[model samples]
Target: MSTFTENAPGVAEQSPEAAAGFTLNHSMLRVKDPERSLHFYTHVFGMRLLRKLDFPEMQFTLYFLTRLLPEDSVPEDPDERTVWTFSQRGLLELTHNWGTEDDPDFAYHNGNDAPQGFGHICFSVPNLESATTWFEDMGVEFVKRPGTGKMPNIAFVKDPDGYWIEIVQPDLTAGLGR
Candidate 1:
């Protein structure tokens, strides 16, 4: 298990004085079964399982996968194994820490659409139309379609695990929509 501290030393020194340039390293999601989530992410979306670690001592497994780059292109540094590569875009980290025998297998549920606390992860696509169509063809259900006025030129889709993802056309509001 990895521990993340928001106000860590170096992380708070990247800005002038007390202004911290905090960067999001990754989002950790505890899953009941890593294999099941892996299959869902791989088959549904085009994500590749980059690496997996079986910590017998910790009694858990950590699998890092992403849609940014192929698994073979990942660096050989074990320390940096958790780092994912993207095509000029940030990468996502899907964490599946093994649950205990008493832990309940909670299915994914859409949380309140807010930026507070830990919410759903959002991804941007080049074309929202094609992306939505592709997801629909795969039998994926979306929580909302575009044009609700919540987010212009953007649509929201959910994964098999019910994790929300936002698909938006790049630069949708770049003067053209105005």
Candidate 2:
């Protein structure tokens, strides 16, 4: 019963200081199977499927996901391509462009864990140990364990498609200037 609105607030209304800070709103990924990726994200991370759009002409299916929370609500923005929003801390956008020319060679891996020109999406977790164990129990392969010396207690894990996800702790002391 969710609806899309064209009267959503602009960037200025959201955060005026971030207007010029080049903030990252969402990260898009091209997946071979939309349903498969959807299952991985929803089942493993407990993310809710906010909305899904089908473009018959373009042969594409866009899926939007967000962390579930009591205050989570969708925003309206007809001027932007953003399909959905969540009250969660961050946004996860899954793009499945179907019927296009074959993209069989698309791989999320870029050699090293952190490759130049490669972007890895990060998410904050309440407890690093619990999140790590949850993913491990779900058969997700981890790239590394939590490293303490770093700014944030971070651990890297790979998705079913081999995409990297940086799991970080929400402790403020773990970040810079602590």
Candidate 3:
């Protein structure tokens, strides 16, 4: 089977509704431990908690995080925060199903294995060498150290959840100026 969508000439050509404004909203990951994921994202990666929603009956909670501007602040009110969080782009959503972290055998397939699907998330730094050094200083685990991968200037590291996060230095690794 194909992974892409097939389109009919007329219906898939274009439409007014399809042309509406679009934003690359947020990407969600199922985290085993909320505390660990939260710490990694907030302290290590420097993302702010935009909002959190808990469902007691469903036994799960959702955490919305994003890297906001220095001047931007999340509202204290729940409604306002939800509205604001969804309105922005480039957000990360961490979903925690209660008790998953406590299970000794539970593991979410990271999709880079034999079945191969979701590969990794990435962050671009101003300088690859400096960033990789900083990650080392912080005791972060490395899947592929800087200057060692197929893309030598780029690096890949594993998070607490065993999810791969690729790091690149724009203008050096990816050939795009930051």
Q: Estimate each model's TM-score.
A: 0.65, 0.67, 0.85
Off by over 4 Å in 3: 1-17, 174-178
What TM-score does prediction 1 earn? Answer: 0.65
Give the Cα error of residue 19 in candidate 1, in Å. Answer: 9.4
lDDT of each: 0.63, 0.69, 0.84
Q: Report lDDT (Cα) of residue 146, candidate 3.
A: 71
Per-residue alpha-carbon lDDT of candidate 2 for residues 84-149, written as tens digits (9 for 90 to 100): 353233567787878432566666554345555665788888898888788878988887777554
Clashing pairs in 3: none
lDDT of 1: 0.63
Ranking by lDDT: 3, 2, 1
Winner by TM-score? 3
Ten-residue stretch with the least lDDT total in model 2: 79-88
Q: Ranking by TM-score, best first?
A: 3, 2, 1
Clashing pairs in 1: none
Off by over 4 Å in 1: 1-23, 69-72, 76-89, 99-105, 108-110, 113-117, 175-178
